[model samples]
Target: MEGGKRGDEAGPSSEKLGELSEKLNEVCHVGEDEEDEDEDHRSNGVAAGFVPGPLVSLKEQIEKDKDDDSLRRWKQKLLGCLESDSDGQMEPEVKFHSISIVSDDFGEINTPLPVDENQIGRVLFTLKEGSEYRLKLTFSVLHNIVSGLTYSNTVWKGGLQVDQSKGMLGTFAPNREPYEHTLEEETTPSGVLARGLYSARLKFEDDDKRCYMELKYSFEIKRQS
Candidate 1:
């Protein structure tokens, strides 16, 4: 009788486990149908399906779902962030971690500081056709206080501008590419790429007990003349 009663108690829990299992599977699905070539992609586009990459063995929570509004809302919010505009502006407090990039042979900026005007005579480079240069950034959080929207899984971006005098540069953040396979694995941003002097600035703001480290780096692009 005890065994039968235990089985009766376990039935609903087993069903709940099944539901959570399905939800987890759904979250793991990133990217889209490859046959649908209408989609444009720069990196492996398969990683967009979850909140946290390698979300640490979700196992399954059964009883919690019956009244877990917090978990449900969290799940919905995460999916919304991922599905929202990838090219749109990000919220404040989104801290950028690091910036690393390389320059072309014609390129030359190596130091964190921009090169002197006189040094421009030496640093000038171009991109090698079909070769992929990388720019990546690690980050903590990005959220719009007004809307409470948060951006996730960002990569280091390129096209940065420097004020030189003010030591300010154009905002750079994760671009939507790569990480498709690394879904939820916070990809790195690409660095300023061109045939001249360049530098990138990283900024960060913190919330939710997450500490952010913002670092900046600059690389010179050169071409062998």
Candidate 2:
């Protein structure tokens, strides 16, 4: 009771107690912050507000983050046909007209012509086994590829009969009227445009074993597809 009554008169000791209390409060606050920091590190592998590790400048990283493979781009193809003649000893430039595109087993419009029904000559086309595509293709052209091959003596007196297997002598022979082709002003496709391909072929009889009636084409089907 006596000490409590004198406490009011003794002010220096009270001030010391207050200073000690302030120090203790500061220490408690520091301890709590350290515990919070440790808890944050355990949960997130980093201090809540602290930035860890060295800061990296973007200039040092530069273009390294981009993929190198992204540089390639899609490209389109050109389609059409041109012909050359090789009957005689010297090769001759052939002119072609009435080009056509044919297909078989066309399951869809956007896909390539089926294997069996792929690009070939003749309106009569064959489809592959289990093929769901359409057949028969034709296109217009100004002239035949081997234009000069149908000169005077080439036609028989008995009227021209084209050997379908040999392109020139067959129905398309120049002297034959039944299968004669008329020149069209357009280089555009007229008959079949399966998917998106165009084709033209030339057949001819040759004494040279090295050459046979062959296919000539420059049709563009979407290769990117």
Models 1 onward score TM values of 0.25, 0.17
User: lDDT at 31 for candidate 2?
Assistant: 18
lDDT of 1 by residue, 1-225 (tens): 122223322333344335543323332222232222221241332323423222111212222353544444443443333324332333323434333334342333223223345543232223433334433333333322111111221112245332321111122222333211111221122333434544543322221212133234443444433
Q: Model 2: how far is 152 from its true place, Å?
A: 26
Model 2 TM-score (2 dp): 0.17
lDDT of 1 at 145: 17
Q: lDDT per residue, candidate 2, 82-191, as tens digits?
A: 11211122222223323333343333222122223354432323233222322122222122221212111111112332111112221121111223232211222222
Q: lDDT of each prediction vs. the true structure?
A: 0.31, 0.24
lDDT of 2 at 152: 11
Return the lDDT, model 1, position 81.
31
